[model samples]
Target: MNFRAEIDIMPLKELLDPQGKAVSSGLKKMNFTSVEDVRIGKHISIKLSANTKEEATTQVENACKKLLANPIMEGYKFELIAE
Candidate 1:
């Protein structure tokens, strides 16, 4: 079986996002005042072969924990779709 994983990695809420803040400031300068705040994150898509959805889930979670996201500063979530 083949599976596709969609992952999101974001800075922890306790941490400051300078990139997001910069974008927010830029938006306000451009007269988009309704936007109060912004936070930037990464979206990742992965396709892999696995025997079952549970195996795919484990693979995706391991990827996130070991390489894709920083546990101390970032958090991640993912969804798996059968392909």
Candidate 2:
């Protein structure tokens, strides 16, 4: 079986996102005052071989925990699609 995973990595809400803040500030300077509290995150996609959706989800979660996301200040979520 084959699976596709769509992953999102983001900083914890309790943490400060300098990049997001900077972008927000830039937007405000450009008269986009309606935009505020912007947050920036990473999106990733992967396709791999697996025996089942559960196995694919486990693999993606492991990858996020071990390499993709920083568990100390960042969190991750993923969607597993059988292909």
Model 1 Cα displacement at 15 (Å)? Answer: 0.5
Writing each residue's lDDT as its tens digit, candidate 1 over 1-83 gives: 99999999999999999999999999999999999989999999999999999999999999999999999999999999998
- Per-residue CA lDDT of candidate 2, range 19-55, in tens? 9999999999999999968999999999999988888
lDDT of each: 0.96, 0.92
CA-only RMSD, every prediction: 0.6, 0.9
Consecutive 10-residue window with the lowest summed lDDT within model 2: 50-59
Off by over 4 Å in 2: none
The TM-scores of all predictions, comma-separated, are 0.96, 0.94
Worst 10 residues of 1 by lDDT: 52-61
